[model samples]
Target: MRAAGRAAPTSDPAADASDLRVIGRVAPHLWPPGDREARARVVAALAFLLLAKFATVATPVAFKYAVDGLNDAAADPRAVLLSLPVWLVLAYGAARLASVGFNQLRDAVFARVGQRALRSLALSTFRHVHALSLRYHLGRKTGGLSRIIERGVKGVDFLLRFLLFSIGPLALELAMVAVIFLVVFDLRYFAVIVLTIGLYVWFTFKVTEWRVKIREKMNAEDTDANQKAVDSLLNFETVKYFGAERREADRYDRAMAGYEAAAVRTATSLAGLNAGQALIITAGLVAVMAMAAQGVLQGRLTVGDFVMVNAYMIQITLPLNFLGTVYREIRQALVDMRAMFGLLDQPPEVRDAPGAAPLRVGAGAVRFEHVDFGYDADR
Candidate 1:
């Protein structure tokens, strides 16, 4: 236990170590040994994820072809009536639909796996809290402890969903888009894509790292406020007897005041982060579109190609837009999970001896032989 005056833990080498440890601990639950059904579900989910990403990457290509075919048909009225690019249009719509459908299927299939892991981890944490010695509980804050478990459980769910769905798929799609740019379009397009991605990722991570501190401050105040409220309410009769309602309200208000300040900082920092991200994304879009337009004017690429570049840029931007928020939440979740895992790391104060026989009573009788107990062993 930390002293009251001690500062809250920040992200450091030790915290990173704990975060890795938590991931390792939770991994087994997600992919439990001897659970064929869970394993099968995981495999199916991956299959769907791949299909979804492939469809997503192909959507822009299909659209490009549809546009090209329509442009050709427009050159001749007879061709316009005969060759309306129906097949290309259908393929474009189908690809878009398939992308969404497969993504939904992946989530539906993996829902069981995520929820199971959440339940298992939550139950383990609950039982471990109960098993800890009374001395430990007596010194703990119930409200804070409960909040840790609640946040940790929620963290597990978010990590499972986003780490697999958002992060992995984003990487896969980015790679595919890069390949398309390199193969079908000019190398310049690919270079721009790579540079933009690099800048966007680096900026998002740096800003999010700073925001994490503000988030931690907010969480600490929130936990403190909750603890004060719960503690006051639990001792309601004592407060009434002592006529200290005003004192209790003042204490709670102080905690809330800190929370309010921290909350405001979080919101303001988030706005700045969003603004910076938007600037980067917009700059990338403009640069790429300008190059594409130049290619069209120089007869190096068609109007359809310009539109395709725009489509792919929009596709990439959609995920990049949320990158900051997702990264921040994941970091905060790690912090929460680390706290919960700390409880699980504690060794029980009492345990049955190895291979100890169970007590059997024919006629129950209390027996005491030199038994002495004190809450503090030092006493």
Candidate 2:
């Protein structure tokens, strides 16, 4: 998805269709145009991933059938146990093999796409930063600007990885599982799962959003204090000569105290959020178990059904937990991305004029205009 670079124009419709199929198949509309080689790699990687997710979904159904078979042959303990091992081996083996293949493919694709993306971002930032008029950079804190860029680049990578890999498949899995529960067992279980998931998500956002704000403020204060500390250390002789060591120490203490308070506030809020999540998960588990027990007492479900329900609950919750975290991170990432793109959008003060021809080698002469520079009035 490196869209910044120039792309070759394709005059052949068939070729263009082939290229688009590869892009849609691999990255699935996540990133924009990229180099030709990278697009091919992405297509292959996506095909592998599609198969892998199907394998993951099929595994549980395998267990469901194996359980039904065992229940039918309950009289012969040997036959039941034998069927169990075969099914387990098949399901586990298939999943493990698919996972390994997917990982290899993913790594190869990541290497190519990752490098290109980083290169594009770095070049964009470097060119933009240098092109700025002096007054603009002077008005901004260089250290703060640097931090913004660092966080922004990292955010882009995070979004790309999760959007295509984790979020999409996990969402599909959740929907399928819900349908299975609704169609096979009881729709009530689906309701329970969805409800718990909703509450879990609500708390995660409310808490993380609050914390991110506090954290940002704390970070800004910390950066200012750090800069001051560095300034003092660099001018240590002057500080001692002016008898200002105690004053600098007091300033540092105040900064640290504010940081500590903000940290405690964030921690306390998170603890409360975690406690709420745990309570929701525990309640959901108990409800599912109770329903399973009732089904067993009424002969509506077998021991295998109980096991399946429990397993499904676990699979459902794990992703629910993940979704909660991902949601929070995404909100923060969006904020970070805005700042990064804002930086990226800055137009250069001096750019090549349209239709400007390149200077011919050995035929150009260098010239300097009457340029004046000043750092400060004191200079």
Candidate 3:
């Protein structure tokens, strides 16, 4: 029998696959073959995504024009109040609203697609678990199995939403911002933005990889604690008869203690990651703003140009700030999914011969001929 507070073993090969491979396994469910309606929703959602990103990028430009218009009409207070600045301000507001509106529309359209994928994978996993042999079921902890499936389903939903919406949109916005910097500003500004982004991404991935190991330990302890609690509760009559309540509680507490330590380590590492990311982003912001200030003083750029540059920097870095969190979660999600998929990879221990005919009896007496059956053949 498997010991309490220990995770069941899974297929190493399945668990060892890359995150992209895991994602590929999920892609068919998200965009199923020959499903016209689902495909249409996905297309519509992507269109809305593009629209939202376009509006998001345009918002700062409108604000820049409004600022410049106000500066030009500074001598005429009435013109400042009731001229081109007013329209540009209105356009800015509209662009902001459009960005938000399109994002919501995208979510609304894509909700069904994500839900369908979640439901499909969940049902498949459920069926697979049921199909496994009794020996496999007896060897595994029920609570840990459920936890794996639960986490895997949640990971699928999160991956579907973020991979399509957050990561792709962030890349598109960065490319647009890069072009703006090069065309409107100078190569120096472009270089700073690129270098900062590169470093931030590199640092986040490296740190998050370290954190993934800690998170895995935490997850293992979580599973162990859950398994013990469940096993104790399910066999409460046995515990009562044996008077082992204290023993069960001690086992649970030990598992929880491990989980607590792992959790603390995870949080501590996260703090370091956040601090490092903030430092890099702050340095980049300072460098860009300093250059913009120099440009303004030298008459090469305007107050509006400075404001626009600041807006673009904020726009790019804001998502980047969350990039670390998103990437970490994605990695963790892949791990959870790998465990669940490993369950599906397990082959059934008993199977009929290929093309075996179904048994048919008219008047039959069951007979055992040369029987050779043992639960453990070595025994």
Candidate 4:
């Protein structure tokens, strides 16, 4: 359980109760040094990720080769006598396959380790909750608490896998793309791409924070609406006895109306965010494209180079959307995970003695049929 020699987290009444530091606390359990196999799995996953990244970068290059080859063949039909175009086409497909193959392989390798971590967190929280005092359970709602547990389970899994596979990998790929632009293309391309991404991120974070607040309001209203409906249904007999069905329906409708308005606001704001991100990306693409087109006009770049530049930008830019999604999800999910794991932070009212030994029994040991316990003399 508590990572041998490590004391369990205690409830600190004086501690800042903002975020529970969920990721920080539970992340280490994902690959405990005690498990050599987990370390190996992570290493293997990283290797696959590296290969996937290279393959992804190479895909645009292969496309460029194919495009250039065909363009040359067309310019000089005599060159068509050679079948290099055919091979280039095949190379393009191979590059695409390699990129996809390695990405899937990376996910497969890391999945088990992520699940193992999820299980550990689940087990730790499960045991911790059972160890807490009866009052904690008495004060909880089974339905709401179970939902928290489910979402928390999902949160931990997503946090581990997404951070490792999505967020971290995307950043690495973007860096690699920037480096490629600088080394193979031009500095202007690199600068434009970087600046655009910076603005895109800044704009997304700013708008997304605003949207998060709206979503929270919507969720709160939705929860209130659901609670009203549930309470109304459960007290149906009372409503019927009083002939208050119409009144109950009116209250429920009012609650839902509030929720509907909040939901609409959330949808409307999300559209704005999407539009802003698209504008940023499109502007960046146009700037880069203008540079690439100029190279073509000057005969400094072949059609293939233009195609490659476009392809690479598309590849690099697609993840910008996911990067924003990941940032928002991590913030939201961590909030849930913090609450779920907060149960673990509650100091157990009961625990073993500092050096308690296991109870010894003979071959035929008797077990108690009934037991009694107490917290103190007052109880």
On lDDT, the leading prediction is: 3
lDDT of each: 0.84, 0.68, 0.85, 0.77
The TM-score values for the models, in the order shown, are 0.93, 0.77, 0.90, 0.81
> Could you tell me which residue pairs clash in candidate 4?
none
lDDT of 2 by residue, 1-379 (tens): 0001111223457645654543333242334374577777777777777776666666666666667766677778777556664666577567757766775677677667765665677677777888887767867776667777876677666666776677777777777777787888888888987777667656665555556656666666676677567767878899999999999999888888887887777666666767777788889889988998899899998777787787777776776666646655544454555567678778766688899998768866878899886675643
Candidate 2 regions with alpha-carbon error over 4 angstroms: 1-34, 71-74, 77-85, 96-104, 225-253, 357-379
Best TM-score among the predictions, by candidate number: 1
lDDT by residue (tens digit), candidate 3, 214-281: 67788888899999999899999999999999999999999999999987786666667778888999
List residue ranges in candidate 4 displaced over 4 A: 1-20, 75-82, 221-258, 357-379
The digit string of per-residue lDDT tens for model 1 on 221-259 reads 899999999989999999999999999999999999998
Q: What does the lDDT read for residue 240 in candidate 4?
A: 100
For candidate 1, what is the lDDT? 0.84
Ranking by lDDT: 3, 1, 4, 2
- Candidate 3: residue 6 Cα off by (Å): 20
* Residue 265 shift from truth in candidate 1, angstroms: 1.3
Q: Cα lDDT for residue 12, model 3? A: 45
